[model samples]
Target: MTQNIKKLGYFLLFTFVTLILYLTYLVMVQGEQLARHPQNQRIAAQEAGIIRGTIYDRTGTIIAETNWRGKQGERVYLKQDQLTPFSHITGYVSQRYGAFGLEASYSKELLGLTEADYLENLLDRILNRTPRGNDLVLTLDTVLQRTALNALGGRRGAVVAMNPKTGEILALASSPTFDANEIDRPEVWKQLNQDKLNAPLLNRATQGAYPPGSVMKIVTGAAILSQQILKPQDKIQCPGYTVIDGQRIKDNRSHNSVDFNKAIALSCNTYFALEGSKLSWDQFEDNFKKFGLSATPDIGVPVRSGTLAKGERRNLSQLAESSFGQGDTLISPLHMALACSAIANNGIIMKPYIVKEIRKPNGKPISVTEDSLWLTATDPEVAKQIAQGMVAAAKWGTATAASIKGLEVAGKTGTAETQGNSLPHAWFVGYAPAENPKIVVAVIVEKSGSGGIIAAPIAREIFSMALAR
Candidate 1:
């Protein structure tokens, strides 16, 4: 009996140690996640009394604010006309549904938890004064955002516009969107969740991943050029099709023979398939990763990382197809925008950001975002060479619709084929005033006909409006 008791004591001690270690691990590794979880009642209770901050656009246009109802704060999204346009960016804060988007990502600042003055917080706590959160100044331009949504014309799509040199997101518009104010209704929420086809709650601009189509030729051409596999003036014969490992990939039409720049301008599938097929797996994958695929943009909100097929499973055929942006590769609108921004900014991709400043309730600045380098996609010379090809594309090729009169526009268009019976997704990525780019835009129209027809025109309007500012 004594021996049995000793064994039980040993087991109890071991179990106790394991439990302690598990708890420690949770605290060390997942403490923040647990605290910020939507279902965390403790967090909800703590935030219930705090008056959240107001949100404003780059032009000081009010986006959202809070209304106090006797210690219970209610979030009221303003700008009635822009309710749906800014919904995905501002998100909603609810006692029942919790918070999301900028609201959840910067909740601490919105709850006044990260105030610069600890003594003021102490005094407020001692006096039991009502807590107010900091105000957020975002980089979004209201006019540009509205223009982007209007250009979509209620189509299911997304547009991301940003400053190439600074990475300040000027507009992020995702269509088939929802009004955050209505999400509080159980019936409305149920309907939104049930509509899986549109997925109104999903922020397509940053979250939706789609095949990039010929727009990916940008990366392919850059990769081949960087590796000395092809030169800008190198000529390749395009007989309307090219075979890779017994599979024939067809181009839009036969170009007979064209140089690298002309091939990009015309989006010659044959040229890219032949040239890209020469790249080794290491070179192909490295260029894609370097251009910001398989990684999420650090923009203080949820963003889906671009994806690529497993390297080990890759073959010559798959590589050829992926060279022009097909196969298992996928990229988000924001990711594509950053890639084009790299070329416009002298080969440097700046870190993308939305929030420009954080201000106290009294209008004093607390924090500000500064532009920083995220990646060097290629040498300046290589980027310049690629930019020239895109200029030609915009001038008279597939991306002509995106060109503005008297403005040197540089861009590439893509018509990404979809699965099943769905139509192809239209894509256009580019920047304005090629000599001195001011804004870079990425537009994707889901299940649309062609990038030049369906997407490039929209980018033109966005660029026109942004430059007009």
Candidate 2:
């Protein structure tokens, strides 16, 4: 009995020692992160004396700033009247609500509290003077952003526009956006949180995940071409429906027989389903990963990682459905824009960024963002082949609504079928001036009708405005 009691004592002592070691590890490694977390009210209290930075659009128009009244700084959003359009981009800052969006993402820099400025901060503290934060210049175009917001017509969805070659995000807009200026109010904050259906606070562009519908055909087509499973001239017969693993997957209409390019233009699900069945799961998944479809995007704000079902877990019918974008695969509007950008950029996907530069309050630039490559999805020639099909899609196929009068737009449309009787999500992803591609835009209208009818037109307006600029 004494030996057993001694053993219990030893076990308790070991567990206590392990707990101390873990606490020490956390303090040594994650102390700074824990302190800077948005939920940590200590940072907010400390920042009361600091003047937060101003945020500007690419054209130098102020979007957000802190107005000083005596020694107190009041965070103000300049375009609060047009609330929803800029809400997700600027986010909200409140001692009560903490911070969100860009405000939270760059809190240290915006508060003049980065480790690099420690000496300067100390000196300012010693002098009892408030330190002004560095201002941020974003790549977002206010005019284009507003245009996208208006184009959505107040639907529940998102729009993401970017420079395909440079990777500068021109606009990121999510509908049903709440007013950041009013988010600090207790009642308003409570209402926004309780309204789960609309989810006005969610950044749908980066955070919302939906099944990628027919738009995923782009990845499948690229993979099919890259693997030489099918040549551009290779022919396939697409019946209205194709049976796989004892389940039938149907296309909207039948294309009697089509070459590779024609199949993509028509978005023939039957053709893609058959093609998908031919490739091994590893080959199929590798192509999607190459485009970074299932990865968390590196950007200024927080984003949910794109997700797809594991190949090993999916049966033949499930794989066929996924091949046409109807499986368990889900992605964001931002990711779809990048996929379109890869084809537009000669197969190179540039890392998308929103911030253009950081400047001191005196207007001296401290840091400027440079364009960098994120991924090489395919060879230039393969991208050309995909572009040809996308061009056909925009010109005379399902995505004709996105075509501009003088510009050759290359695009793909998706009408994703959803469960529980709700309307399918409409999707359009494309780039304008196909040969000399300038802008890539992705649009999705939740529970909307057809991609051709609803989403494509919205992208057309954004493209026209962007190219006009």
List, residue by residue over 6-121, the lDDT tens digit for candidate 1.
Answer: 99999999999999999999999998887666566776787877888899999899888888999787787755454467889888777778888888887778777763746656
lDDT of 1 at 295: 77
TM-score of 2: 0.94
> How do all models score by TM-score?
0.96, 0.94
lDDT of 1 at 115: 34
- The most accurate candidate by lDDT is 1
What is the per-residue lDDT of model 2 for residues 1-469, given as tens digits with 9 covering 90 to 100? 9999999999999999999999998899998778667877877887788899999999998889999888899888866336546789789888788888888888888988877678878888899888888899999998998898888877899999999989999999998888887887999999999989889898999888999898998888888888888788988787789999899888898898888788878889998999887877788788888997877876778787777787465788888988988888888998898888889998999988999898888888889999999999888888899899999999889999999897899999999999899999999999988989899999999999999999999999999999989
- Among these predicted structures, which one has the highest TM-score? 1
Kindly give the stretch of ten consecutive residues in candidate 2 with the minimal lDDT sum: 77-86
Global lDDT of model 2: 0.88
